[model samples]
Target: MIAAFLGMRLYSVLGRKAEHEEEIIQGRFKQEEEARDVPPPTATGADSARVEPVIAGFPPAIERGLREISTADRNFELIGFMEGAKGAYEVVLEAFWQGDKEELRELCDDDVYQSFAAAIDEREAMGVTLDNKLIRIEDSTVHSAQLDGKIARIAVIFVSDIASVTRDKDGNVIAGSLDDAVESRDIWTFSRDIRSDNPQWLLDETDIG
Candidate 1:
């Protein structure tokens, strides 16, 4: 019986079916298994595999054009155009307050500037001040940019909250509080036409009404 049991354990160990139970059975007859089980070799390209970098195509001309257009389009931003608008608004607002048509000649559109200036003059003749306050930018977006010939017409959507105030020449606020802001929106199109003599950037026109 002992020999038969020892023979069975040896057969199981040689067949690679020597579990802890087989070891116990063989050890009972003072026999040791030839080899112990070990984990399988790790498969290559399984975990932590390095990936190859993808090659991207390059179009130099198209890339350059896109960059140039992006740079020109930046002029329609709030802060960028705000500087010019602030200056223009200051002149227009003061002229409107004083009713000075001559001061708005080169600063604004002819008809609109003249009409606004006339109104200011009429009010000033009556001892009135038109307090125009530029409050906050409600919305701003680039409407369109069309490249025509060698020029680009960039249209921008400008919207803001403005408080038009009225003061008595003494600098005393008579009407319209700073809190009295109203929504005002407009589409301003600026044209940049390439020139031959200058060969530089120039503002050809600004839509005003």
Candidate 2:
């Protein structure tokens, strides 16, 4: 099941080459310097009733939820959050494949971290290692967004192509092929406390889309 879910398809010449390069994991939620410096909008007595502009094209429910989240957290920006989510997806996948538990712990919530750690432990017991490559990300969009009190959760649907291979202790390919890439659709939810000073969001849930 894992093998079947972890194959990739090349989207372009550049993507094909990128699949072979070492994964560069950077700050998962780092925003640009200029973006960070910009202060959140403040409403005085007259402008207190002003409603934030909602981005169109999303479903009514999603739009409502996003608006609620934005209201709760003045620093929330849809475009920047989506970009950061995409980067987080790549970083988390590569860290899991490399069995980097420390990195995974920092990127994911406790429950999610435990799930990934358990999978790594199982693979180690079997004397097998995953060789997975994210060939291309075809799409990454917000599927849902909601705010519960000061906690905001956003689920993103990621449509990506991955190449995966399982190697035995002797370095022989035991399952999957790197040449064949398959599309995978995953819904991953990230959550953050709007009241917190830290701007980082942690992966809390994952599902097949």
Candidate 3:
């Protein structure tokens, strides 16, 4: 009788401990489930009123043209396109000035390619070579834009400085600078068919200033 009583008392103590541990586990699970139900913090007050749009600092004509292009091409971005134009400016001039017709053909139109070829030929016949290096592009702005049917034409004005000098076949400085950088302004026009899949814009015309 005594042994049976002791065994029952031990079992009672173990049952209470087990129930206590089960209660702790259930409480933890409930806390975790409750935490998941809470919503993320809301951005209230002035934060809710802030809305950003494309900022324009161009002339009314340019702004209107940009809007037109934006309507036609949803992916067109002003700041990014301007930045790319600046890079293309450097690439095209670097190739043309160095008499790389193949590279020029990839960047410019047929007439532009022919003109560049003629200039290069003239320079070659004169037995004078040009050593030119772009120092920096000071500024670049879109002068105008027009959408004619499916084609989009944009004229950009680029102001740049370069270190350049002309030397004869025997290496004589004929013109320009070898050390000092000179500024050059060019109004370059580019055209592309917006409906086409090709994203490359061709250099159509240029006016030097």
Top candidate, metric TM-score: 2
Candidate 2 vs. truth: CA RMSD?
Answer: 9.7
What tens digits encode model 3's per-residue C-alpha lDDT throughout 1-209? 32243224323321221111011110010111132232111111221112114426668887677667666755455555565567667767677567787766766666655666666776677676667789999998889887777667777888999887677789887666768997878777766666755444666667764
Candidate 2 runs further than 4 Å off = 1-54
What tens-digit string does per-residue lDDT give for candidate 1 at 1-209?
32243224323321221111110110010012123221111111211112111101224443343234434433222233323433343444455445566644534433344345445555656565556777766666555555555454444455778776666668786666777887766554433333322211212233322
Model 2, residue 84: C-alpha shift (Å): 0.3
- Selected candidate, larger lDDT, 1 vs 2: 2
Worst 10 residues of 2 by lDDT: 9-18
As a TM-score, model 3 comes out at 0.71
lDDT of 1: 0.40
Candidate lDDT scores, in order, read: 0.40, 0.68, 0.59
State the lDDT at 198 in candidate 3: 49
Clashing pairs for model 3 are none
Q: Judging by lDDT against the true structure, name the best candidate.
A: 2
Q: TM-score for each prediction?
A: 0.42, 0.77, 0.71
Model 2 Cα lDDT, one tens digit per residue, 27-77: 234433243232211111212133344345689999889888877777677
